[model samples]
Target: MNQDLFDNVRRLVTTAAAGLAARRGEGLAEVLERLAQQDIGPGAFREPEPRSLPVLRHLPQCVGEAMVLDPRLASAIASVEDALQWQQSASYTDDLLGAGFSENYGWAEIIGPRGFFPGDDVLLGLLMLGPERHYRDHYHPAPELYWPLTAGSFWSRDGGPFVEQPQGAIIWHPSMALHATITRATPLLALWCWTRDTATPAQLA
Candidate 1:
């Protein structure tokens, strides 16, 4: 692992986690720690040939609104190159799965020095969960934030009924809030954050 890179990501995760804690505490602390340790940046991130997936939805509401509230947040996203990379082989059932991610899920570590809005160590970014035929219920150990850049996706949490989140829907899940999603008609795309406890990834119960 690159110590320099780790330091950068750690700083970012810590800042972002702190920010997320203001709105949501405890749940995100771990995610922040985990992200701080990764090296998923330009070095490991690959640039692939141009290709397009069949289904994808655009994010609405938040991007512009966030920019209006905090112009710097919008600008921060530009620094992380891998944030937009088409990950790869998200789903495998002949076609894509609803929550399975059509391509490999991508995370751009938008929290550290090179990222947007310096001074903030919060871990946040744009994410794309390619289409899956079906998305099973899974929950994370950290507080999570979701601002779907795409539309027409359903979100549900532990025993809770599913809710259709259109673009710009601010969805929050406290730690261990069994959540599951499904995409229909088209592919689903959204922004996601591990907030804190960066080491923890969601698991299907």
Candidate 2:
């Protein structure tokens, strides 16, 4: 990874990590720290063709609704989606079923054993969602974090009411909690993570 991009990503992760850690918890803070030493988040786009699951088609509905919130972010995600050629894998075909919002939603791996930064057990990605999309209840064993680059997104856990976090806000969910995401404005362009226990994919209720 280029030193400039590396430093930029590190800054984003460190700042985002500290803020999220204070609001969410310590696990996420640690993940950011670990990521600082590796090529995880920003350099994700450094490679022209990185390996990924074959089928990336599962994300359009939920993410599509996000455009109503932030057209710019929606545009960015849409552009990324257009450039991507999905590779089929268990994560696409079998993993995301029952999750809300069918279109305009997408996920790309940034760090993980099979992702941009292989041998880095921690899993991370960029999450794009369209306006008005609701990611219904879901659970996973891995602790998770979200650093929303834009505003107007809501998050909930264990059936809790959705809470709107601000731009640059960090949302964290502990392992196996039933969680969901909803966006009203500024289609989400957020950094996502599963610091550990990434073997278990996300499962929707």
Candidate 3:
């Protein structure tokens, strides 16, 4: 692992978390505080095992738009995009989501069990959904927060109707809350985190 790259990612997560804490309520503030206290030493990170997914084709555009919303984060992410290990949820199959959707939806873990930096009980990563795709409701033991960095994306929770959120919008889902996402004309790119209870994987609702 490149020491400089690891440091840059740490800086990005720290800056983004602080910015999010300032704009969010007490719940998110608490999560950010806990995340700040994690030990992200040189040994915490390993060389990423990169994987190419269809959704990654749209990453350049998403990163370009994200630069306008959060320049530092966008730059930092872009700098290390090729080094991140992109992966799809194990539970999602072609039978679950259509073949088209399965290929075009994936996440890149930045700080988690399989991420560049192994988190003890916290997970931070990026989620990408391609244009005009529906990511059905799914639930997990870990409470989650999503910070969308691009436009034209819609989100829903607890089986509710999806609502469009603008750039820098934050969405929170308590543990085991059913949540889903949709992308319109543009692809979706968001920073996501799971605070605690990171053992269980997400299950489709």
Candidate 4:
């Protein structure tokens, strides 16, 4: 394990968490408070096998936009992009995401059971969706918070119609609440966290 790399990723996670903690919105304060109680010591982290998906091809462009919104967080992620292990949810297969959508969606766990830092029941990561893609409705036991770094993305919760959200927007999904995402024209990049009840994987609605 690269100690320096681990330290850098840890810094990025803390910086991003602090940034989210500063936000004023529904569910933000509660999630931030829970995050504050976690132990993020180096001992809690272990390097995992690195992986990537085709969607990552758009990462640089999305990160470019993210840099404008939050340079510290964006730069930190860019610095570790090459070393990060990007993966996708097993529940979302090509059949569920539509014909070619599977190729356009991917996520990387920065802090979780299988991530750089083994989270104490908390999960922090990045998610990306390519242009004109639909993630479809899905839900899990863990409550989720998403911080979209780029624009042109739409969000829907509990089977509601999708609504456009601009860069730096914050969206939260309560436990098992059906949620979905859509992107048009431009790719989508966002930071996500699952705070508590992390054992269950997401199920398609």
Q: Which scores greater on TM-score, model 3 or model 4?
A: 4
lDDT of each: 0.50, 0.60, 0.86, 0.87
> In angstroms, how far off is 86's CA in candidate 2?
6.6
Better of 1 and 2 by TM-score: 2
lDDT of 1 by residue, 1-205 (tens): 4354444444544444444444543334555565556555444433323233433232233344345433444433333332333333223343433333444344343443323322223455555454443566767676787755556778887668878876556677877888777666655545566556545555656
Query: Which digits, one per residue and each the tens of the lDDT, describe model 2 over residues 146-200?
Result: 7776678899989999999876666778889899888775566676888778887
Tell me the lDDT of model 2 at 115. 42
- Sorted on TM-score, best first, the list reads 4, 3, 2, 1
Cα lDDT tens digits, model 4, 1-205, are 6788877887888889888977877778767876777767766767778888899999999999999999999999988888788887877888878887878998888888767877778888899999999888889999999999999899999899999998999899999999999999999999998989999998888
Residue pairs that clash (backbone atoms under 3 angstroms), model 3? none
Where does candidate 2 stray beyond 4 Å? 1-26, 36-100
How do these models rank on lDDT, best leading? 4, 3, 2, 1
lDDT of 3: 0.86
The clash numbers for all candidates, in the given order, read: 37, 28, 0, 0
**Consecutive 10-residue window with the lowest summed lDDT within model 3:** 21-30
Would you estimate the TM-scores of all the predictions?
0.51, 0.63, 0.94, 0.96
Give the alpha carbon lDDT tens digit for every residue of 37-88 in model 3. Answer: 7777887768677887888999999999999998888988888888788888
Instruction: Provide C-alpha RMSD values for all models, in order.
Output: 7.7, 6.5, 1.4, 1.2
